[model samples]
Target: MSDDDLSEKVGYGHPPKKNRFPKGTSGNPKGRPKASKNVANAVELELDSKVTVIENGRKLKLSRGEVIAKTLVTKAMKGDLRAFDAVTKLLPKRFREPLAEANKSEPLDPYEAEVLERYISRRIAKEDSHD
Candidate 1:
């Protein structure tokens, strides 16, 4: 019966009183096997913004942030904290080139192949829900 914003009457507004995520704050929240997905700006990021710096025939196009996040999580899951820390430090800088090259030449790494395949299969299932 009023034109005013519904939340505004309660003293909140269009924007949340407090954002769940601080700007640029990264990491997963509780109670999930998967971490955050579908981040913005990252999808719109152009290839030219960061070129694949391949070397020794290994390559990847993913951002350093993405690589570090995946690597750290995998390592942590395997209970290899030292490896996790090492990968966190290394992948963003040192492995960026090799990963870029490796990605270009190979299907997926042994570790990632299955994960990607399963994700694709699930996505396809959802998309073909009518069938």
Candidate 2:
């Protein structure tokens, strides 16, 4: 046998061209199904589904996301610190804080002003206590 044929016979990593996979075919044709949705898509579908919830002794139907948000807010209001953090995280960035504008002079509403004052005071107190 020629050295080329001998090397092909004992090739370490390279498979013979003829016996290798065809140009377009996948190595794992039976692998994960093409229609399988990813985690985010699955979660979104789940959250979009409606569920029954009780509010003020009245049964109401709401999306899973709404139910979850309500539950998180209720827990946070009841002093669950982790839930508070989760609720904050779930809020849109703009809702969490006012967007900065260089030229806009939009006045803060009473609630917004109160919240801002409380936030600033807490931050200042925290900084003072750290010193």
Candidate 3:
């Protein structure tokens, strides 16, 4: 069809000229806000933010990230299995491998150990696949 004929056809997948935005103008003129930060930047800002907490009768300043790590470790120390699992996952491979090896001799609950092994193996496989 000719350009004129195509432009005039406005039933489906096309809108009437009067309803369309004018040529050279935008559907969103203002576009995304200039002040908006991306997710990574926002997360970095939040993790880097300072927090004050009383530690052993003394007030101490810590980053939000540090506070989160402290809380995770504290919960794990109190026998929170989920928190312990999280801590183990966050540990570097050097530390984690040795811990996993040590667990073989220490005798973890059979079911629990099997589940943990499966989870770690799956995580490692996923990470390797990504690489």
Q: lDDT of all predictions, in order shown?
A: 0.64, 0.86, 0.91
Name the candidate that leads on lDDT: 3
Which sections of candidate 1 miss by over 4 Å? 1-71, 74-90, 106-119, 123-131
TM-score of each: 0.20, 0.46, 0.52
TM-score of 1: 0.20
lDDT of 3 by residue, 49-91 (tens): 9999999999999999999999999999998889999999999
Q: Is candidate 2 or candidate 3 better by TM-score?
A: 3
Candidate 1, run of 10 with poorest lDDT: 8-17
Residue lDDT tens for model 2, 68-120? 88889999999887898898787797876753343367789999999999998
Using lDDT, rank the candidates from best to worst.
3, 2, 1
Q: In candidate 2, list every pair of residues with a backbone clash.
A: none
Clashing pairs in 1: 58-101, 58-102, 59-99, 59-100, 59-101, 59-102, 59-103, 60-99, 60-100
Q: Model 3: how far is 87 from its true place, Å?
A: 0.6
Q: Give the Cα-based TM-score of candidate 3 against the true structure.
A: 0.52
